[model samples]
Target: MIGGKGEQKTLRLVARHADIWHSFVRPHELPHKLDVIERWAEREQRDTSGLVISNELGHRGEDHADDLYDAGVRLFTLAFHGPDWDYDLVRRWLRWRDAKNA
Candidate 1:
């Protein structure tokens, strides 16, 4: 389910009903979002051991990537937007990320 705004409650409901929680995340707010997830897990007495946390990183920014990783974000979808989509830029960023991870 794609949603925002009322995400805390929605996440709880989704956690209970769905197998995965795919959600969007703003770079600066990722920590708080993870905190909410941890809190929700504790409150619900739910084991969130294998929950998949995915986010779209539309541009290449080191801090954004680092913050997302620190917040336990595992999956990322990179996006490029413009009249002419830039595959080169996306490829460069992917290489950089892979190098960093390596």
Candidate 2:
């Protein structure tokens, strides 16, 4: 779900058939997109509580983890490119995950 039309179409199927929805929307857009999913789920008589929301995190997303988490994103896929990958983000997120679980 990337473009507006594609996202909308995907969301409809997500509501009816998906147990997980992975979104590329930014942190600010998460709530609204989630609301749309909820509405579609309601239209289909589906409960979204069991629906897992996943988001991808690049360097730009490091600062917004809390915001996304608060918005109900439970799964995060971290992206690292290039031949030399920096593990700092990985360490940071691991620490954050530990603290959250603790």
Model 1 scores worst on lDDT over the 10 consecutive residues at 1-10
The Cα RMSD in angstroms, rounded to one decimal, for candidate 2 relative to the true structure is 2.8
Question: Residues 1-102, candidate 2, lDDT per residue (tens digit)?
Answer: 222214468888888888878887777897788788888888999987888888877765545887888778788778877688778878888887787678
Candidate 1 residues 12-72, lDDT tens each? 7655554555567666776676567667777888877777677767654767777876677
Which runs of model 2 end up more than 4 angstroms from their true locations?
Answer: 1-7
The ten-residue window of minimal lDDT in model 2 covers 1-10
lDDT (C-alpha) at residue 44 in model 2: 91
Model 1 C-alpha RMSD vs. true structure (Å) is 3.0
For candidate 1, list the clashing residue pairs, or say none.
none
